[model samples]
Target: MKIKAINGVKDILSDEIVYWQKIEKTARDIFRRFGINEIRLPILEKTELFARSIGEATDIVEKEMYTFVDKGITMRPEITASLLRAYVEHGLQVRQPIQRLFSIGPVFRHERPQKGRQRQFHQVDVEVIGAQEPQVDAELMAMGQMLLNELNLDVSLEINSLGCPECRPDFRKKLIAYLHERHDSLCDDCKRRIEKNPLRVLDCKQQGCRAMVQEAPSIVDNLCSACEEHFAAVRKQLDRLEVSYTLNRFMVRGLDYYNRTTFEFLTTDLGAQAAVAAGGRYDGLVEQLGGPKNTPGIGFAMGMERLCLLMQQQEGQQEEQGGADIFIAALGEQAIAFAAPFVHQLRKLGLQAAMDYSNRSLKAQMKQAGRLKAGFTLIIGEQELEQGRGILRNMDTQEQNEFSLQEGAAMLAEVIAPDKA
Candidate 1:
């Protein structure tokens, strides 16, 4: 039997890897600018960690989690659980207060795949721990906005507060009562949620459930004095920073631990999966994971594959070209021998250089160079090799220039450098 990758998983080929690399590099650079160091958490974590942090009744833990018991250990489906574990087990114990960290890696969920949804997909996550100030939330939001802007994506921010523990229970009680009154009209999933996780009733995507919750009480209206004040402060900070957002009353995320500020960046182009990124303050999450009590934190995670899809759409709009700076073609046996070292030197100088390793004829090498879309083609013939010189032909203009190997390499380097040429 031929084995194949399960559905909802797709391999990223070389042609598409550059898009991810660009996104990763940009995100890393921005995080570094914000003084966030990288933290690589394990792909797997204890099931309880997620059950506690992400919430046991949510779809992630209840329906989507790829949970299994191994050697008396329970493994979970998502990376956020492992991330929280790393924070408590290592970050708090080893690192200083107010740790700012980011992680980008694959997360798993047993879900049906569509255009942007996948069973296994990558997420660029940022977590700011130990900061209770609302400005931390603003900073996280700004960072996310900056990343999307850097990717040239036009997106809208939908922000809301899930209220704090001080108020959430009262709200949950009222919400559950209200949902129970409409229990007959509620979707089956939401009917179950009414008993187990009533807050998620507001997050139900089903049409009937959404309509029921639409008339249901809003958490914003039921927030305690402190949660109300905190929510106002977070909004004030965001406004002060000029981060535009729309207040979404029904924006309670799918997770259980999220509190106070919750947000999602929506784009209309992604079809039914409009949210490319979403997260918020999970102040109780650290404590739930057995960390410090009341360790306030805010963070966000972006679906990388979805971002790449949006990026491809943007690239299509821009109609950009992707190609290397130089292609080196050899004409003879001696030329091949000489060109190999020359190509190496060019690459060592941080230039993208390729040679026809198949030992094809000069005409065939030139054709390959054109197909590779190399900006310039360097030709090394017997005479040119003997003279320690090469012919550099501008692929676009078809204009040729004779230069020594060193000069040709320098010219290629200058052409590749943004500031130099």
Candidate 2:
């Protein structure tokens, strides 16, 4: 019996890897220009790391985390907690007051998967640690915009402030009071969230819960003096950078650590899964997670699977060109022997060289070359071997040229890739 992949997970085969490669490449280039360095972390961490950082009330901690109860380890549902854990454990603050870092990897969650979401999904997380200035928040959003722009993705940006510890309690009380009045009308999830995390009810998607919260209090209106100033400064800097954005007062982060400025990049192409990227400030989290006191941070993560889906939707699946730069079709056993080493030499010179090992007929080999979409086909038959030359045909133009067989790979490399040769 053939085994099948488990539900909520799928393989990214060769044909689809090109989109991922382009996304990663574009991200790296943008990160480099922004002076952001890369970081890598383990997939598993002590369950307490998430419980403390993500908050036990979160859906990720309550229902979605893939935890081994006996082992006390859990697969990471997101990257921020693990990154903050690293920052504190390694005393990264001693080396630099502020560190700009990014990480690319898969994060595991136990959600019911749908289009653009999987049990194991990839994300590109960017963080600015130890920077509390409002400009840092603005610049981070700008960096996200630049990355999406370079990818040619048309996504809208929405910003909001979740306030801070100083003033959020007032908003929470007011919100909870509002929720309690309509308690029976809310969804079971929102009803539970009312006490544990009243803010999450504002983010609920259910029609009933969403309608209940339409008249709810806005956190942006409840910011403390300091938080209000910081938020205003963030908006001012974003304006200075000419980064366009709309205010979303009801926006609330799924994680408990977020505070102050929060934002998401939205797209209409992905149906209900509208957010392609999202993030916010977490001023107190570094200290909460055993890092030095007052080490402020803000970061964002782009859902790679969602980004790829948007890319495929905008440009067809086969938009990226794949296959060999050149295909060597050797007709006879003697020709195959000669072409084998010749192809290897071309590869060493930085060329995507492919040759069929099967000693098939010339017509069959040419057909294989066509299937590979080879730019050039080098035909070496008994006749060409006798002539001490090979006929290189430009697959596109169908123009053939004779090259001295004795010169071998060097002569061919120069012809195919003049810049490299």
Candidate 3:
């Protein structure tokens, strides 16, 4: 039998890797500007970490997680729990009152894969630990919005309030009552979870389940004074920044930890995976996950696969030319030997340079340079080497110029260096 990548998982080949790098680079640059440092957590963590933090009743813990049998370890289906483990384990809150950390990595899930969803998917998680103010929530949301905007993605922001432990009891009571009224009509999964996780029905994708919950009471109207005020203040901050958004009452995110504020960045480009990014504020999670007494946190996560899917939908098979700024083509053995050091010096001077070592003919080497889409080709032939000169051929326009090999790095730097304003 021929070996192959498992179903629902696909490899990101070299040709498609440029887009991934561009996405990662854009995120890193924006994250730096926000004072959010990167945090790398393990791919696998104790099953108890997720079970206790994300809620054992949640679908992730009950169905999707890839757990081991011998020991109680599981591949992380999400990052928040692992990050919280690191935070509490390292006592990060003691070092800094406010911790802004982000991570981009693969997360495992055992689920039916479709267009964007996968068995092994990547998420860019941004978390702000040790903050309770609504502005922090708004700032995280704004930063996420800014990232998608910078990527030229046309996505809409939807925000919701799930209330806090103080007020959530009344809300859940009302929600359960409404759901119980339509219990018979609810989907099987919805029926089983109605009394336990009734809010989940609102976010359910099943058509029957969605129709049943449409007329159900909105959580917004049920928010208590403190939760209501926080939601109002968050909206006020967003309005102050002129960040347009819709108040989505149905967005009770799929997690037990999320409370007060939850959000999703939705895109119509991808079918089932509409949410390109989603996150919320979890106030009790730190305490729930055995952290400090009361460590508040807010964060958002972007699915790389979904984002790439949307990007590809917007921009088709246009290849980004991944090439050096200069390609050195040497004619003979002696010419090639001289070209190697020349290329190295150009690299040392911060120029992206490449050369043919096999001594391919001048015509063939020039063809290789053209394939690389190199900006300029420094051609060193037997004659040029004896004269200490190389013909520089422009890849774009079939123009050629001569330069001294002794002045290679300096000479190339002068040409490729960005112009001063």
Which candidate achieves the best lDDT against the true structure? 2
Ranking by TM-score: 2, 3, 1
lDDT of 3 by residue, 1-421 (tens): 9999999788998877876887899999999999999999899899999989998888998999999968999999999989989999999988998999999999999999888999999999999999999998889889998988888889999999999888878878888988888888888899989877888889899999888777888888888899999999999999987788998988988889999899999988887778999999999999887888888999989999888877777854354846778899988899988878878887887778899899888889888888888988988889998898888887888899888877758767687554310
Task: State the C-alpha lDDT per candidate.
Answer: 0.83, 0.93, 0.88
Off by over 4 Å in 2: 315-318
- Which candidate achieves the best TM-score against the true structure? 2
Off by over 4 Å in 1: 1-3, 72-76, 91-94, 315-322, 386-388, 405-421
In model 3, how large is the Cα lDDT of residue 109?
92
Q: Could you tell me the lDDT of residue 163 within candidate 3? A: 90
Model 2 TM-score relative to the real fold: 0.98
Cα lDDT tens digits, model 1, 1-421, are: 9999889989998778878888998999999899998988776666667777777678887678776756323444655667778888875735588888888888888898899998889998888888998878887998899989988998999998888867888888888889778889988888888878888778777888877677788988988888888888888988988999999998888877788999999999888899999999888888888888878888889999999889888645342347778898898788888788878877788777899877788899899998888988988888887788788899999999886776656666775454534
Cα RMSDs, all models: 2.5, 1.1, 2.1
For residues 1-421, what per-residue lDDT tens digits would candidate 2 score against the true structure? 9999988888998778888999999999999999999999999999999999999999999999999999999999999999999999999999999999999999999989899999999999999999999999999999999999888889999999999889999989999999999999999998899899889999998988888788899999999999999999999999999999999999999999999999999999999899999999999999999889988999999999999998888854445566677899998899999899999999998888999898998899999999898989999999999998989899999999988889879878888878876
Question: Which model, 1 or 3, shows the larger TM-score?
Answer: 3
Worst 10 residues of 3 by lDDT: 412-421
